[model samples]
Target: MTAISIAPAATRIPSRHRITKVMRLQMVNRLTYLGIPWIITGVALVISIVVAVLISVSVPEPGRQAALEGMAYSWAGLSPFWYLAVVGVQAVSAIFPFALGFSITRREYALGTLVTFVVIAAFNATGWAILTEIERAINAAGLTFHHFTALWFSEVGAGSVWLSLFTLQIVIFAVASAFAAVYARWRAMGMLVLWTAVALVVLGLIAFALLTGSAVPIIDWLMGFTITGFFAALLIPATLAFALGWAALHRAPLRG
Candidate 1:
């Protein structure tokens, strides 16, 4: 008799619950990807300024070679503009992955993120570059990327090479992450071509360094890597992220 009694109640999902969950996830992911790079860029710039000032005051105004030595040890020095390279790339990295869900398919979601990424890259890089220039003027080392590269490739001791390695890793990571992110979003052939050209220029810089036996090689490589590797790398991931997003946005439907 008890077994025949009642029917079960149907479940209803609250819209707020769904909205909150998605919002929370997106926010967390945004912070993880965007926050990390931004902080690094800022802190690096600060350290660079301090080190540059210290070098300027601590070292005696000397000959060209001595100036070179001081430049080598200086922090962010004259490359704060390099942050555009980092944060700009990071913008693409943070949002493209989110495109995988396609849940937020407004035109704004698609284009806005890229725009924002570009803005962040540009703003941060510009600010950093300006600050770096100020530092360089104060210190007056006249160092070049080529100079740094020569030290990196030479048979210098580990201490000499570590800074180069750190720089290379940071640069590569920023560019790679940007490329990967762009790839996840869409196939922007024009942008890819631009990046490819940029990367090639980097290669050219390398060639120039080699010809001159200067530190410029690393800068060349980084330039080449950015335009070429990252320029095009963004395309592939962008496609995947778009495809998945499209699928998710469309509810299950019957095949015609």
Candidate 2:
């Protein structure tokens, strides 16, 4: 006689434990992997200030000098957020294979990655909020430096500021994750096809709008929403992207 034991499927794939494991693994290389973008952003900020100062000193025109005084270099700070796309891409392109080696199921990995990205997005949004407030205070003190308080970023003293930032980050993260999953399953050709498909869709939409003479109405509709509302609306696409990304990764093959 032989004794045998079987565990339920749910026990085998407990969502909480699996997600925790993935999150822990993600944190292991957090410094080296996550810190690179922040470091580069800091260096760029310092360089831009130095360059601006040099330009201000050398340029002779009074109007040009005044224009340079309160230059809204908000785009500079935002450039690093794009690096998060690379982070998401690496999460799949690099870590997904390693996680699979540990026998983590695709469902668990995908959910865990989503949770991890949300947390990262929240963390970044909080930091950005703090920086934004600090920049505002500096401007009030007549420093004229604008690091985080761009017109599109937030309305002054508005509560939706953090929400808008978080929403934006989530949408960007979801898009990156979806793209990475596509690449993981299909590699270089997949990315090319994806880009081409996106281009065609955009072009087709433009043509349709032009032919229908509905471009103004469409633009007007878009203009009706506040920035926060517009970004909040992106949550729908973000959710869709997450679902699609999970589906893609579910059967995604390991790649080098």
Candidate 3:
């Protein structure tokens, strides 16, 4: 009689485990995601300080306080937030193909990318909040330098600052992810169409505002929102963009 042989069955990994693994894979390039952004922020802070000093020295004595107060309105401290959007694009355009080659499903990759965004947003938000407090302390010491706590943060508490930063980071990152997903699925033409549509929508909004004569009122209403409230309102668009990105990735080609 001939001997019979049995083949072992393939073991399936749990969904959560696979998702976490993909997240870890996305975080492999720490310098791109973390280091460069902070470096840019540091450089921006230094530049802002130098500018503040120069303004203090060059301006007439009576206007010195006014110039420094205006300097407190600078947006240099949030420089890293814009860079995070580029990081988001890189996360999808560069990393997706590698993950696919490793047998990662599109769903797993999407979840992993989203989780990575959340982690990064939280980390950066915490850092920004801490820096805001430190900036406040420096200003308190009669330095008159303000970088991290500019704009609406001039009137808000620490918790509001953190919430605003966290929400804004999510919104920026998610929007960039959506754009990157479009590029991944359709390349240059896709990006062109996306930008064209964006421009059209912006023009339409501008026309509407001009025709309706509500521009000033709209601006006033928007400016009326508290720091926390404004960022909270951003959650709506953030959710929509995040969902669009996830959906786009599901059909993206591995080679794009």
Top candidate on TM-score is 3
* Residue-wise C-alpha lDDT for candidate 2, range 105-182, written one tens digit per residue: 787778788888888878877777777787778767866565566657535354566877788889888999899898
Each model's total of backbone clashes: 29, 0, 0
Compute the lDDT of residue 47 as modeled in candidate 1. 65
Q: What's the C-alpha lDDT at position 138 in model 2? A: 76
Task: State residue 156's C-alpha deviation in candidate 2, in Å.
Answer: 4.3
TM-score of 3: 0.88
List TM-score per model, in order. 0.35, 0.86, 0.88
Alpha-carbon local distance difference test for all models: 0.45, 0.77, 0.88
Put the candidates in TM-score order, highest first.
3, 2, 1
Candidate 1 vs 3: which has more TM-score: 3
**Range of the 10 consecutive residues with the lowest summed lDDT in candidate 2:** 65-74
Lowest summed lDDT across 10 adjacent residues in model 1 is found at 145-154
What is the alpha-carbon lDDT for the whole of candidate 3? 0.88
Give candidate 3 regions above 4 Å deviation.
1-7, 53-62, 213-217
Which candidate number has the best lDDT?
Answer: 3
